[model samples]
Target: MENEEETLLKSQDSVEKRLGRTTLLDSGEDFEMLEEVDDGVDDDLPPLEDAGGGRKESHQANKTVKEITDPSQCPPQEEWLDVLGNGQLRKKVVEAGSSPDSKPQRGQNVTINLKTTLTDGTTVEEESNVSFTLGDGDVIQALDLTVQLMEMGEKALIEAKAKYAYGALGSSSTPVVPPNADLILEVHLLSAVDAPDLELLPPSERISLASRKREQGNVHYQRGDYAFAVNSYGIALQITEASSKVDISPQEEEELLDVKLKCLNNMAAAQLKLDHYEAALRSCVSVLAYQPDNIKALFRQGKVLALQGEYADAIRSLKRALKLDPSNKTIHAELSKLVKKHSEQKGAEQAMYKKMLGNPPDINTVQKPQAKSSWSISWKWLFGATAVAIGGVALSVVIAARN
Candidate 1:
């Protein structure tokens, strides 16, 4: 079977040929190579399912659509124009909106009716009257990026390359998208309005929005899309932190702080998955700043520190977490592994230095031969005996004289 990356390349080629184009997107970077991009994420961290607990049903689980795998049956791509001029995203207008002059801008609240289908004519998701805030990470990056360019009352068919769509890990939504699969979307923009400032929204609404983003992050994380997960978590943090700038009841304040900290903790985990150690460390520190006793934050801080080779600091952070949650076996195991690894690292350094310096002379061993030589020992005994005889003779003469 062709791998996901190969499938992506083949699919893009097919689409490009159908559109009478040589290349649809930048072919300079392979999708697999894109996955290797430096992010501070650590590969050694536990897989999403293991670290995040059991998977939750995708929020869009109810939006399942029937699959159609006939390769020859697809929408015509002749009129498709590259939206971003980068070939990664393309669109063909099916119906023009009423207000062409008024397009949705970033941070605007937009409502749309959308039907999503795979290239094989499989309608994966169809929903009417969906609403989200633009650039808030409430929707896929492709939709958010493309929709802002859409005119009010416009209906268009969007063809997104995998990078801007569900990406490498794909989507776990109903009709499950395979990894690296491109996305086909039929979207109708119903309405677009200025989004309320996060500070202007009711405390409850802000919390709800932030919580939803956090859940969205969880979905992305479970699908092994750490980059998207990190983005979603970051949005949640922004929402919660923005809400903090406005005065609110103590209860609301506490709730917002809790949500913010949760986002920070989850963001750190996603960052770790991306191998972004410094960013992950910052996220962990942010969470700890709000709640010093946060076990998750401390534990993540330890992991990040350890990954960055700050073993001593890592040990301190883990120990702090262990002090709070002494019964946590995960923390205990992580701490033990860190301690053992640190010891091995120290031992390796010592051995390296010793090898470089060579062995030093031992003072006791150097003097031992001279001190214990047979001739030296014999001479000492002879000298002592002669001295004793001389003293004895003198004493005898003295005694004889006295007698």
Candidate 2:
């Protein structure tokens, strides 16, 4: 209501000025006496647009476009910040984030909604709302630097030089920014996950955090994100050890150890899915290192080792696992498989050995001579005649000498 009145007064003043009526026409000579008229129109009601054939265009014109004429209007600039080390880059915080306590770390993974615009106000891309790990060079350096300074649920506007973004080459074919162009990024951090710092936290806190992380890992595992699940479990294990290593009540100790074992087992499961046998083996070993008779660890170790073709070690681990949990059908089945595989491998090796270094050839079977034919008799006669001729020549020579 107030805005309409204000607009009306402004319009009236402008019309009066155009007519050269500095003061209201004191006398009624210039204009006839006009009486106040009420048009039954609500003062707050919007003016009707042109009721013409181009109704849509008329309606569109009714909307008052708010143009940002000032850089300060972009966002509330509480303070200006020089960022990205060399101090060429900067950010103006429009609205402070809600979760000031949840700021992202250097190596944490973050999901953000990004809006890139050129100085001339051309939209470069729609790749905002994308997920990526920070500090991995998966995104522009300016973005990484910008996000590191932002808290969860925070939004910021980044002003960056080309070097921090696309540099001289100017990024991809339809580059968001041309060569040597500065960019403005309106970014919102959707979510972030930071690796836990287990070593410093209190023991009770460690156990609690460990449990939470383990559950998070389980959720990731159920979602089939094995790599992330493994990461979560790794964090859980770190907390577990940190809790147990410090001074703790016996009950707390047991709780921490239990969480550790479970996390290790879950880690191994995820690693198995990811085909990270060595990592899976390490997880199992970690569990076994604490509790030597942990059935799950032994079984997982056996499974990993079996897949690696270490039948002997796999059998040993599985047998131990089975002995600890004799009623476990899975363990028994796995051990049987390893044993069977071991026997088959041994038999195959023996067969190979026998084939490669088998018995020497038998005398009778040793490649016998070819059978003789009519040609052999002819060859023998020729040889005998030559020998007889030579013998006769020798005998005649001996007689001549004697004579």
Candidate 3:
């Protein structure tokens, strides 16, 4: 008795034969199925909440902010002092700080409580205990520039023109600000600490600090601010490298190395997004130097090399990655595309060379002298005969006439 599988197969074969075609089968190609790659494009950077765990700055805007429409309720213009001398930014000290002589400088990491509002007293953003490195552009220009003028524990009110705030295109995120909207901010300088010399810190502390910076970078990256992301990652990298000379336990050293590699990889990702191909490639090479088999580094290195027109090296790196993870559809898809592109490039180069050299005409197509037709040859002979006869008759007539 024929089983169901056998019957189906037989029927299919018969139909294929009748149609004069063989049934399709897998060609065993390495990259047969193309799929979308998660090449860290949409990847969520490691969350800051668990990274060192001291404080995570709030990104949520104040949804229930109240609006005060009365003009009388606003601060008087007489008390506002121009901080920048350009009149774009003005400050009014609400309360004096504890340390009058010590103010936070540009490079210090500072913590603060801030409340921002529109000109009509509509609060747009409010957060407490938010910390950021000064002059890092982590906050709005108004906050960054205004906070510099305040001493430790000082409370101040700032009025920033649109140029110093969100500019013509106002805030697009939550608590959206309209275009060309001037802003008012109430700022409390909680504390200011100078960025420590990483080399002086113990290895454990250095690693923790580096991790925190890396988390900060992640935050910047998630917000689509690639340049700032690169900066934060670069700072984290500096912190990581600073601890390498310090004597530490083997475990601590290993952990530090891991963190350093992660920072490099993340930085490379950011650099790639920014189209800084050379810088991104160098970062990938740095990671590969420490850990040759690092998959993420290898993958990114391949992409960077391809962008720089180094197809051979790119293919090599991607092949290595694919070897490590043979089943990764994303890697397979990427490698296939690169291989196809390289082939097309070679083909185009060959075509261009052929065009420059100019193809020789085929011997068969070259025109040969045509043999004269019988009719034309006969006509030429007849004309020559007639000319000769006429000349002879004329000569004879002249001789007879002279005689």
Highest TM-score against the true fold, candidate:
1
Write one digit per residue (lDDT tens) for candidate 3, span 1-403: 5698899778766533432232121221111111223463324366434222121123231221221224656455444566555787777777877654566788789999987777765667677998988876667667777787677888887878887776665655644677788987889999989877776788888888788878767866655556667878887788777734567898987888888898889899888887899999999999999999988899889999999999999999999999998987777888999999999999999989989999867666553422345556888999999999999999999999999
Prediction 1 TM-score vs. true: 0.70
Which ranges of candidate 3 are over 4 A from the true structure? 1-44, 47-69, 76-91, 96-101, 116-131, 137-142, 159-184, 244-247, 361-403
lDDT of 1 by residue, 160-196 (tens): 8887777777655454666787777889988888877
TM accuracy, model 3: 0.65
Ranking by lDDT: 1, 3, 2
RMSD, one per candidate, in order: 10.6, 24.0, 25.9
Say which prediction, candidate 2 or candidate 3, comes out ahead on TM-score.
3
Q: Give the TM-score of candidate 2.
A: 0.46
Among residues 3 or more apart in sequence or in different chains, the pairs in candidate 3 whose N, CA or C atoms overlap within 3 Å are: none
Using TM-score as the yardstick, the better of models 1 and 2 is: 1
* Candidate 2: segments with Cα more than 4 A from true spot: 1-104, 107-200, 243-247, 359-403
